[model samples]
Target: METTMLPAIVQVLPGDDFTVYAYCNDGAVRLLDAKPLLELGGIFESLKDPAFFRERLTVMNDTVAWDIKGNRDETCCIDLDPCVIFRTAPIVDDPLENVI
Candidate 1:
């Protein structure tokens, strides 16, 4: 029998065009496109601002999240499920490979 482990997000980097680079525990960098979600309106309205989006990007609840209020309040912020991201997002090259 084999056991499967889900990847956990360790870091997040906001990219241009509403994309996010999620670094996972399994050594994978996944790219998440947030443009469609931002266009949904409602709670996501605050994320439409590119500056706010990049500034607030963070890791919360063990996943890619936004500390919208800057308080680190998990419940008040927006977060994406790690499993969803690991499964749905395509693995991408680390954007900081040359920087660090």
Candidate 2:
């Protein structure tokens, strides 16, 4: 529910430069750090765990935004919450669909 101020700095893991992102809406974030999978031979279970992602991920916002400082596209959704992956079905549309 925070706004204006950028969130805290998250650390980057080994391998690809992907990082996490945090925003004010829906306490959004994304775990862009593609390290664990790379380290585990490209198979990291946490990526697909519903509860785990729900516990550590967030929706960020209905619109797509990126974390400038994150190096990667990771971002924040909640304190450490997961996201509702399928809730986006009804909202998916062309980029210009909602434009003025």
Candidate 3:
């Protein structure tokens, strides 16, 4: 999948990080800032499915879905407080030293 065809908002199910790469059907790579790719599918596994706005979503627009396999964290709703890793970096005085 080409980058231009990719969707703007992606919601990862569970066990997803920014480093994870989402490969579209047409061979486009998109780096998710948060959990854009749903974690329903297993990690380190190849997922095969049509792109949808949400899981169990019937309407198919330009969103890219997955059917991968591997390790994954199962959570229904994402928590904003506890899941600090997903949130933006905290304010820090040091620029280079504070890198995650």
Candidate 4:
């Protein structure tokens, strides 16, 4: 029998197009396209602003999150499920790999 552990997000980098690079505990860098969620409106509406999206991007509650209130309160922030991101987002080369 085999058991799989859910992925834990360690860091996140937001792209201008609403994509997020989620770096997980398993050493996987997955890319998440957040446009779909933004289309849903409501609380996610605030993230439509590119500046706000990138500025508020953070890792909280073990996943990619948007700290809209500028506070690290998990309950007050919007977060994505790490499991879903791990399963759906394709693994990509680390964007920071070539940084000096």
lDDT of all the models against the reference? 0.92, 0.32, 0.29, 0.91
Question: How do the residues 1-94 of candidate 2 rate in per-residue lDDT, one tens digit apiece?
Answer: 8655333323211112433332223333333443344356322444344334333433223332223333334553222222322132122223
**Residue-pair clashes per candidate:** 0, 22, 19, 0
Instruction: Flag clash pairs in model 1.
Output: none
Best by TM-score: 4
Every model: Cα RMSD to truth: 1.4, 14.1, 14.1, 1.4
Question: On residues 32-76, what C-alpha lDDT tens digit does candidate 3 reach at each position?
Answer: 333343354444122223232223321113232232222222232
lDDT of 1 at 74: 92
lDDT score, candidate 2, position 1 = 88
Candidate 1 matches the true fold with a TM-score of: 0.91
lDDT of 4 by residue, 1-100 (tens): 9998778999999865889999999998988999999999998999899999999999999999999799888899999888899889999999999999
Identify the superior model by TM-score, candidate 1 or candidate 4.
4
Better of 1 and 2 by lDDT: 1
Using all chains and alpha carbons, the TM-scores for the candidates as numbered come to 0.91, 0.20, 0.21, 0.92
Which portions of model 4 show Cα errors greater than 4 Å? 1-3
What is the TM-score ranking, best to worst?
A: 4, 1, 3, 2
Q: Candidate 1 residues 1-100, lDDT tens each?
A: 9988776899999888999999999999999999988989998998999898999999999999989889999998899889899889999999999995
- Score candidate 4 by lDDT: 0.91
Scored against the true structure, residue 40 in model 3 reaches a CA lDDT of 46
